[model samples]
Target chain A: MTEQPILEVKHLQHIYMKGTPLEHHALAGVSLKINKGECIAVIGHTGSGKSTLIQHVNGLMRPQAGDVVVDGMDLADPKIDIRLLRRKVGLVFQNPEDQIFEKIIGDDIAYGPFKMGLPIKEVRDRVKWAMELVGLSFEEMKDRATYALSGGQKRKVALAGVLALRPDILVLDEPTAGLDPRSRNELLERLKTLNKKENMTIIFVSHNMEEVAYMADRIYVLADGRNLVDGTPEEVFVEAEKLREHYIGTPDTVEILAQLKAKGFAVRQNAYQLEEAANEIIALL
Target chain B: MALPLIQVKNLSFEYAVNQTKIPVLHDISFEVKPGEYVVIIGHNGSGKSTLSKHLNGILTPVSGDVVVNGWNTKEWSSMREIRQKVGMVFQHPDNQIVATIVEDDVAFGLENLEIPPSEMKERIDFALASVGMNEFRNRPPHYLSGGQKQRVAIAGVLAMKPDCLVLDEATSMLDTHGRNEILKVVRKLNDEGMAIISVTHHMSEAAQASRVIVIEKGRIIMDGTPREIFQQEEELKRLHLDIPVASQMARKVQSHHHDFNGTLIHNDEIVKEVVRLSQREVPVI
Candidate 1:
């Protein structure tokens, strides 16, 4: 939507354990551009390089070949500070346990700000702000034992920890992977607020078609480390046949629409949400 | 002609902290038949995972008992026998995979059971093939995809020839494709007479099960076929659970077309109903 993209990846390629029997081409010529304040989703089957691509965005892994520029800063530049780059691009792993090590919720959230060498008062303020932003009440959860919290609560703590750094670009790998329906909904809502009110650039990696359909303004499909498709949710999801070939699935609404068309119903097979599909079916009826 | 593979009777479990008891599972009772595909659906803290642990003797119930293949879980002497009859696969595949090589990991459980080398070879071959991981048998567990690793984990469980498999959100951490891969294996195993008790939050996956059990606040709140369970979408939503997409779509269509009678648990049924409605001669107001 803008001349300068917030995130730009060009001809990215990565190989794991290169030049060995276990060599794996994790990413192959993957390219994408994310505009500022956009909610972008990277979807792929397992081993399709979704994780590999996101790691490059935050400098967690340097690009083997190709270029990745985040907010106008080329990640390949030798002079760029890795710490500053990571702070600007928040990366949340699939498992919250992997990132959250502090016993107390407040302590875990404050770890990022504290490490950034912020003043103690500012660190505390950011900790409370981050917790509240993720829907965790600071007063109630500050002293709560991290281990005692539910899976969703723990995930929120992990998100809060990253948010405490006030990263401009928030990237999450399967943020709702293990969450129940309610928690998933609550977290998505919170993210939507952040994307809208704060104009945060969100780039999430997920394989959940329904969640992608609901949340993503744009989607990039990866298969075996290669970029397969990229478009709006409706545009990408309508290619149910194409997605299936790569072991990727579209949202249930799109699948149902396809099924209806296959069943000789004169209905548009393009709906990505339940209400839209229902409207299309009702119109046809 | 055969008894249920798992019979949980008046099971109650609680965790103690600082002399205060916190109830986890409250008066839970259920039975899983041989070859039955049973999906346990619940929100976080609903005690679904705790109940799964009770089935395999990982945790003894505070009161009552779990009888697996007529062996009571409460009896300390029957722990090994119960564990043998009921194998468990956890959410994280990384945690479950032990050996470096795929075949070695599959053979880990067999070796623990003191199985002979000749028999172990046959069992491992059968197990790996059943889960469609034979191609990656020689590959390293660390190099395999998440889906492949989980299948290897399943193959490990299968090598022991457990009568039932308890997947404690095993597919929750996987992408959509990985989830389907594991579910396909589980369905195939169930069809071949391995009773399955899968604790999951994926409504679509739950809809494929022969039976669905809804857990809430440490109790078994609803138990029925997928159709019966999904029909009560409102009730499920109240409990922080969701109905499958097809069912949700059917509800939306029904709002306009009152006579749109349809069995809406699966995609095919919804398609058929949409076709029927399109062909109907009645003209709505």
Candidate 2:
């Protein structure tokens, strides 16, 4: 990649319970190049190492025999200042309940900045900005109990916690996993703003192909702990059958086209969404 | 008289948060038939969750009857029987999990019932196999992915052998892979004759189920098959739900080409339908 990627995962291998018979090859020779401001979406079935792979980026999980290099700091290097790197390359987990620790929303948002030993004024400023960025009102939500917030609010607060650190690269594991339509759209919009305005590079791991198709510049497909495929969403989803054989459902548009074609109907396999498919149908008529 | 699996007659509930009993659900009434799959859709604060909790008597209704297999939930005397018959799987897997080991957690419900040792083993094995989690039987719960852990959680309830399963946004916490995995299990269970009532925000996912119920502001707006519910796309949009991506694309193209054939909600159908029509001697166009 040009000028060395912002985040380079080189020959990364991770084995759970290594040496024991119960060991799993969570990641097998995975190497990826993520440049600044690029958003990459990783899609796979459950137990396909999507989460395991992301965890390795922030020293959350160390590779068994390889390294995760972010901005020249080798995560495998014991002497590397992990705390500094963690602050810069922040990780937001899928479940908000486990990640958010403090009682109040403001306190939880400021946890990361406070840990970095920032001045009180700066930490407070970072927390407020982070809260507003996620679209949580500062005055109303800040003083409220964290437990009082709805499921969507908890997620926004959890994200604010990570954003307060001002991480250059953000790694979110299924960030919109269970949000309703409005909340999901809001989160995606805010993320887009961050990527566009702040030049933040993002590695977003999601299972929703539509979201992946809409958001990512690149897509990675994982299966059986192997990097099965890698390309843009457009390129990756074109292989509808292969996607199905791997147990990853092709977006409805792709599947419908494949089915129609198999049943002696003429349709393009690459067409994924319903609207396009409809237009194509109408045109044929 | 043949009793329904679960019946909520004019159910209303309020949560006293901050000493304020906020009315969450009002005048909710429905019945889940034995061996039926019913999908519930609504935006947040639409009382979907509040209603789900009342299914298994997790939350007692304040103003009406929640009858489970002919037992009134307000009378706590029969709660043990009600819980045994109406098992639930919550949205987040981590919160509901009680044991560290996968198999042990799966056996938790059985242990509470004091199932005989031999019977427990038999049930546990069958449950694990049913959800396709037999291999991870010995692994710890913490190590499993959100979807896998959810399967284990399902196994936990399957071992109990409930008459109906209520998944309250269970798939929301999962990635596409996880969502599909759980959906497969849920569908299979429904086919095998267990009553399933799933509260979800995914229209595509709702399309897979036998029946769908749409609610807004704690009132039932529509109840029908996916075809019927989705055909009223304009209404769904009003409730902040989205049409499948393919359908939207089809609609978009239709605005340009009125000659396109068929009801296009997904892409492939539109393409095949189009090409087929265009190829005819007296072309459809």
The most accurate candidate by lDDT is: 1
After the best TM-score superposition of candidate 1, give how far the Cα of residue B213 lies from its true spot, in angstroms: 1.4
- Cα lDDT for residue A88, candidate 1: 90
Against the true structure, candidate 2 has what lDDT? 0.82
Write one digit per residue (lDDT tens) for candidate 1, span A145-219. Answer: 898887778988999999899889999999998889988988899899899899999999987888898899999
DockQ (C-alpha based) per candidate is 0.74, 0.49
Clashes within 3 Å, all models in order:
1, 17
lDDT of 2 by residue, A245-281 (tens): 7878777666666776676666776765556655444
Best by DockQ: 1
DockQ of 2: 0.49
Please give, as one word, the docking class of candidate 2: acceptable
The residue-by-residue lDDT of candidate 1 on B1-285, one tens digit each, is 667888889999999876879899988888888889899999988989988888899998889988988888878898878888899999888898999999999999888889899999999999999999898999899877788888998999998889999999998888778888898999899888889999999998899999999999999899999989999978998998999888888888888888775448887788888767666767768
